[model samples]
Target chain A: MKELSLNILDIVENSTKAKAELVEIEIIEDKTTLTVRITDDGSGMSEETLLSVTDPFYTTRTTRKVGMGIPLFRLAAEQTGGSLTITSHHIDDYPEEHGTVVNASFDKSHIDFTPLGDIVSTITTLIQGHPDVDFKFTHTVDDSSVSLDTRELREVLDDIPLDNFEVLLWIKDNLIEQYNKIKYK
Target chain B: MKSLAELQAIKERMKNKIVLREGTGDIRVVVGMATCGIAAGARPVLAAFVEEVSNAGLNDKVTVSQTGCVGYCQLEPIVEIYEAGKDKVTYIHMTADKAKEVVEKHLKGGKIVAEYTVTDDN
Candidate 1:
């Protein structure tokens, strides 16, 4: 992907496809490194699926022969002197805690690291696209952090759809304000 | 920073407008966003539809959304449009510019841009 947020968008689509009810995305950026972690409560992958997920040619989709999300993300991380890891627990083996967690980190100052694109759009699009799924996003830069919980927003929204243009615009502005405070502080 | 109060005002104004559109079967625009699709630049295409739909104030009549792979990796960044009582139109190898044309020509002008469709190549 051209931007880190796009990568996040790509990965979370898998979580939604896995039938996850709740997906959590976290971004932590410090002076040295930038880390992204996405955790999902979905039908976790099998041990075999998890092992080969990083392979660009491996995909569970019957529609296509190649899955490039993980592999490309892994490459992006590795090229920046960082790493990517995926941990999953199959539902058959762990009924109570069945899901997948992907952790990718990149050196903060790496020349090849892509900029964090418009994350507010990325997040709001996902929330609007999958209204039934709850998403929690946490972004931390240095010592400050901002978090958004769609479950809580849903409680406040009540009947108004999240995809409403005005509501989505508000969300984008709010996220930008919060991220700016942390980023510029 | 925008306030929630603004959203509340919009919600109040939109409530009835939105309620009337329910079950009316609006036009649906689905962008492919699978691994291959994203790699082929589907994100901007999706964003363009959302933006153009809203900009044209056609949200009530048109809904923009996404889908996973559509079995055509070679035709990544594909877009499918469904209108009530009409067959689905699949556009292949789409870009944001092409998406804009689609929104303007097909969605707004009621004329499908035949040249950009998969059937055009065939």
Candidate 2:
């Protein structure tokens, strides 16, 4: 993807596709580096699949073999001399620990570093499409930060779905408001 | 920051109205969002559909959601619209602007935007 947030949106979909009940996304940025971690409580991949995820040709999908999500993410980081790592435990193996964690880091000092685009749109879009799944997102730049956890909202919403048009708009506005607070901090 | 307590206010407002999760919309708009689709700019298109659907007050009559690749990476950024009686209309290589037109013309007017539809079913 052209921007980091679009990649974030794409990777989170993989978690939801695995039927993840909860997805946690964390982005940490310091002077010269940026890191993103996405953890999902979904049906994780086997060790065999994990080894080949960085390979664009490796995919579990039956419809056409190539899966570019992970590969592209890896490329985005590595192209800046950074790194991507994935850890997964399939349900058939560790029933309790069956989930996936994808962590990628980027060298912000690099001239080719990809820009972080409209992340608020990415998070809200994911929620609108899959409101049933809970998402916990935190972004930290330097010491200032912003975070949101849908599980907390669920407690108040009760029966109201996150996909509700009003709720989704509120979420988008809320996220933008939070980001604005930290934008100059 | 917009606090959770504010959302509580919305919840209160929503409680007074009937929640309509059941008996879902008659029309469904599904956007393909796989790697190929995202690469081809499906995000803006999807966003436009959501905003326009809400703006048109069709939230009760139409549902917007996403799906994995339809096995047609060549036709990335595809959108499938399903209405009660009509056959599914697959629009390929769509954009945010095209999405708005589809919403106004096809969805609101009850006529498929044939120019945007995929020609070959194969």
Candidate 3:
């Protein structure tokens, strides 16, 4: 994807597909580096799958012959003098610890690194698209930070749907406002 | 910043309508969002569906969602529409504008825009 937010959206979809009930997405942007970390409580990958996940030709889906998400993400980070790491433990063996964690770091000022595009929209789309899953998003820029937890919102929402148009609008605005406050400070 | 109070008000006003939509929407709009789809710009198309569906007040009859892949990488950014009693209509090489048009003509007006469908050239 041309934008980092799009990449974030694509990567997180894997968590949902893995049947993850809870997903955490963290973004840390500092002076020289930008890091994105996604953790999920899902059916984790086996050692065999984990070993081949970085290959563009590897995919579990029958609909397609290739899975470019990880390979492309790895390329983006590596091109910027950064790195990507993925760690997963199979559910049967690790029960409580079974899940996946993807950490991708990039040189913040690298010329080839894409801009962090419309992250608010990305988060809201995930929330609306997967109403059953809970998401926690934490964005940190320098020393300031903000977090939004769907679990807390669910408590407040009571019977109301989180995907309600107005609710989504509020979420988008809230995220952008909070991120800007920290980024421009 | 937008207020949560505003959302609450919307919930109160549209509660009945929302219920009607959630349980029995007859039309489903699914966007392909796999790696190829994203690389070909499906995000904006999905966003357009969300915006137009809301703007046209068609949320009661149409549900917009996404799928992983449809096995047509060359036809990235595909959208499939399924009506309750009709066959699925697959539209390929979609853009945000085309998505808006599909929402207007096919979704709201009940007339499929044939030129945008995958079978048009076949």
Candidate 4:
């Protein structure tokens, strides 16, 4: 559960690093079959780069090894009786450019899905008011579905414009609090 | 399982005493939260800042925040202090202990810690 939130945060950081104008986030959970998945649209890696990212020493950013974040997410999912897959294209492949799609799946029965909703909410809230960027998040519980489109929310929601620094921390604090509040149940 | 009623109560309490009022003089303490910062133990540093500020009852005086990719991954746990009327002070490679000192010496005492400052000499 902790890894999931950290994964989302790490991917968003990657999106910003990629200078991506749009990112799509999707989460699906099923109680009966017990499955969960998270996918993202950010700078997709080249074939060589994609293969190397899974290596612990491989890193694209000078900040640190990318292996810790995404690799950890992949490990978490597999440890929970599931799997993770990543797909990406080289920069020259598309006219508009391409982004990476990281798909990590977990067995809901092995873990828990109650906290998943808050994860979706947290991601949406964190990406709020970044007009240049858009995220589409979808959540599924049992047979029920709740998806949020940030672009649509932009039209109806009064996005309290906040500077990057404090609001981001508040978002993290609130997300952790909310996740804890909902998790055990 | 937690109930929706509990969430509603949280919302009500939060709405009643929102600390983010218009006139409150906001002090922004920005922590570097990029990959380098995270790997170099910035999360604990960030948490220490928050805990100390809240514990000291200085929540109104200062607000702890985070920023991504400050472009100085070399200085992993970088912190930038932004006061309303003063030039920003950048502090690099901070630890939780150092962060607490920053809070006591700088935030509360209004005196910056020269050792951690990112001045030209240092």
TM-score of 2: 0.96
TM-score, candidate 4, chain B alone: 0.83
lDDT of 3 by residue, B1-59 (tens): 54556656666776666566657678999999888888898888988998899899887
Docking class of 1: medium
In candidate 4 chain A, where is summed lDDT lowest over 10 consecutive residues? A156-165
Name the candidate, 1 or 2, with the larger TM-score value: 2
The candidate that achieves the highest lDDT relative to the unseen native structure = 2
Q: What is the alpha-carbon RMSD of candidate 1 to the true structure?
A: 2.1
Off by over 4 Å in 3: A183-185, B3-7, B14-16, B19-23, B120-122
Local distance difference test, candidate 4: 0.62
Per-residue CA lDDT of candidate 1, range A1-185, in tens?
Answer: 78888889999999999999999999998888899999999999999989899988898888657888899899989999999999999999999999999999999798888777778778987976887889999998888898888777666677887777767777878888887776643
Error (Å) of candidate 3 at residue B62 is 0.5
Worst 10-residue lDDT window for candidate 1 chain A reads A176-185
After superposing candidate 4, which stretches have Cα over 4 Å from the reference?
Answer: A32-41, A63-66, A111-125, A128-132, A157-185, B1-28, B35-65, B68-78, B82-122
Considering only N, C-alpha and C atoms within 3 Å, which residue pairs clash in candidate 3? none
Provide the lDDT at B103 for model 1: 94
Best model per DockQ: 2
Model 4 native-contact share: 0.06
Evaluating just chain A, the predictions reach TM-scores of: 0.95, 0.97, 0.96, 0.71
Give per-model TM-scores: 0.92, 0.96, 0.94, 0.60
Q: Which has the better DockQ: candidate 1, or candidate 3?
A: 3
